[model samples]
Target: MSTTEKSNEKRCERDGREKVDKFRRFLAQFCATTVENLLLFDMGLCHSFPFIIIAALTGFPNKHNLNETLSLTPIEASWLASIGYISEPIGSLLSALITDALGRKVAMMVVNIPLVVAWFLMYSASSVWQIFLAIVLLGLGAGLMESPIITYVGEISEPTFRGVMIAYTHFGYSLGAILVATLNIMMPWRMVGLVCMFTPIFTTIALCFVPETPLWLLSKNKTAQAEKALCWLRGWVPKESVAEELQSLQRYSERYKSCESCIKKDQKCIHPLPTLAEKLKELKRKQTLKPFSIVMALFCISVFSTTFSMSTYIVQILKAYNIPMEPDEAAAVLSYVNNLGNISFLCLIRFTGKRYLYLTILSILFLSAAVICGYGFMVLPIGYSSFPDLSPNFPLENSNLGYIPFVCIILSSFCIFCGINSMAWQMISEVFPYKTRGTATGLTAALSYVLSFIGAKTFYSLETTLSMPGVALFNCIIIAFGLILMYKILPETENRTLEDIEMHFSDNSKKLTDRKIPKLDLSQIGSAKNNSNMPTRPVSIKGIDEQNNKKSGIGCDNRSFVADS
Candidate 1:
């Protein structure tokens, strides 16, 4: 039978529009909530972008115009970098408290304050050293946006749709990277300061109407408020349905009360860490600390092994090729190509591919390109090919091999911005549990900056020590390992229920997403365990966002065929 036939047959058997409609509606409301929440962090880059861009242009260790651009001795530039790093994590720490208290919407609203102030300072910066202060302010703003946005989105969204929302946020990060790459080309680095200044204005305006999360209110024991929030989130659901959902909320709430009460009464008997029982309750308040650490490590590993430094130095890389152009004109061309690469990346997100495969494929492309470029330099005579050895300190097309790798980096960066960026956010969301998601995500972002800093420093440091191809090859190795881990440990969670997913993780079954909905929710129906103490019924909010297919998964044909019936 065709899909329509099977659906029609099932429809005939069901005989009730109300039931089907309720399930479908709930799915729609929660779709992509995580993505929007995560995307808000793009604003964190308002200050960080300028700091990194300015450093790339002038503070680069071996550059010729360092004294001219910075108006400082080369040694002073090192001091400026130290100031930038120390200033960077301040905003992230400030964000943690607000994210848990005021919620994501207000937290994001608060972040604009620092961003606006940081940008104003950057626009007026007089010396490279002055930029150190600007970066510190920017980091403070970034810290606020990162954790709350993740926390708010994860909390608001249903469990099944989580990965897609996270992927959307990852996409936002790529957009920010693209925005900076473009801004750098269209205007002088100083004008880039103005753009950062205004990001908060637009973000704040849009967030004014963002809904408070339903689950968050319930956890805080505001049952009436959770119901009201859900009504908006699940428009068109019948009034009777509200009562059912509210009942579920009550039970879920009591679970929280019971756990908290248990903690208080038993004290030593209740494990401070997540016991199998409290783990069921998500009672461990501090588990976010370790996952946050691992995620930061991963983010740093990523930035270090990638191309932010090289892209900022594109003109230099080409000049190293000894191509024939005045330094100023060559710089202009490099800026134009950088813009081109970014444009291609943004288009690719809505075009040829999406978040996951786009990531894996892009990683391969970047690695291949980096290796090709690295090999080109490594094979060249050490003095001439590496730097200072070749005449006029530029490649004059003797072997022309260096140009090939340079082209590859440019192309690979374009692919990476669109592709791997998507994959990173998608997996990060899945790996993290919902309750600690904000803290985990905050740490993820904090480390992302840390890595970006390291990546920037290492890109330059490696440039001097290793040939270009050598650097590319090393990064390739890193990406390969990341890809392998993802394939082995991760499951395809395109769509699944919150409880259904919990069961999978608890069962340690990586094969769940590929199967039909498990028997967990069904078994709860009319069970004696559905007593006063617990209300673990399947709560489906119709017309809500979760019903939508957030991740764009491949759906199979719905058919029923029998043999020997």
Candidate 2:
């Protein structure tokens, strides 16, 4: 070949190598992010293990059944199951404060302390009260970590990958449920607690190696540290590769600070620190109010839809409905399906928009509930009852149709994990602005837990009062209502940046056209007129003064403005 031909071939070979190398870097980064997310969210196992174990203890035909071992009554078992949720609200509230004040990493580490203690307590418990106390502690730990974990994942992951990463939190919960379900069938509940307790300890150690989120670092004005953290999170890519992202984060932080300081072009001077009333007034901002309302409503819908309540009392519910399977076996199968749903969520989140996916899930859930409730009313024998006595040995007519309710329950579980659960939790981290993220997420999460508490606490009673069919009907109504509200209000957030999601809720954003204006450096603007290489434009002094007066009742001082070209 001629010299030019050889040179062209060599350049092509070099470009191919560069492309391969870039692909390798991206794959490595993705893997590292996946591992970090798994570690950060492993507490999902600890959070969910207790509920299953409690279900097994009260209802499963195990050698260490709490109903027999400790003479635990149904009421006591119900309390053990529902108490965690009630305590979670308090933990969530505390988490909001801790995550904002101490940093997300510190808040995560702090939560492990309670988790370890709660699990250890459960393992060594001899009395019902001890178990109750352990669950309360577990709830507190679960609540405390919820905000930080969601915030950390949201802050650390790229927007392109954020939906999948956030979905991993629910993945952790489903995996935990599966683990505990399998372990519950194979071993005593105490041993299950002991096995699961190690997760939080491992999480604590794993967290030591991970860096704090770059967003949180930037919020604290730790620019160099933020750069380092961002680099580390992006698989330790060279600093220049992430500089553009870092600058964007800096701009977001500055914008937040400017908003906090009440700085605008219309204002004549910078404002001082806000007073107590002024600080409270910030809560009324459109960005805060709109997202907060949407999230809180979603949480309410999720809580009342009987998703968590069913999980918490899976064994009892199955036995109540006279499903033709061992409660433990059904719980295990449901747990597996739950993970499958979460996996489907991870796979589909990239391909689907948030609003569409959510609406689809709710529709399926509503249909599933309707099927189950209809089966109960139409097919069951006339004296069938689940309340006052929940027994796995409850008799059903000998027919293949007995499996239909079980199938519907399984479908509902899948829908819950796939979309209902993930969407609500994902939005908690995505919807709020950085300044109020911890507080808003905390409050919303706390309310969610409280609603979960009510749902869980009332499941058994509702079964007693309304029967399984009635409970299903209640969920159907709530799901339908939620579906309508969500369809009307939820914005599509897939593949969108946090800034874009926040802007979607702002009235001002809707009124303003998309425009990019040059950022003026006040210090440099004064010197622009004297620079030989720079082109300057004249000031519109009267226009500036009139605009300022119209907005803030203040007039700008007479000064010549020079715009640089």
Query: What TM-score would every model get versus the actual structure?
Result: 0.68, 0.83
Query: Which candidate wins on TM-score?
Result: 2
Q: Write down the lDDT of every candidate, Cα atoms only.
A: 0.50, 0.70
Q: Any idea what lDDT model 1 has?
A: 0.50
lDDT of 1 by residue, 84-138 (tens): 4444555665665567567666777877877777778877887765676777776
Q: RMSD in angstroms, candidate 1?
A: 8.6
Judge candidate 2 at residue 291 and give its lDDT: 81
Please provide, for model 2 over 242-270, each residue's C-alpha lDDT reduced to its tens digit, 9 standing for 90 to 100.
Answer: 66556556655654554332332312224
Give, for candidate 2, the lowest lDDT window spanning 10 residues.
Answer: 555-564
Residue 517, candidate 1: Cα error in Å is 12
Best by lDDT: 2
Model 2 local distance difference test score: 0.70
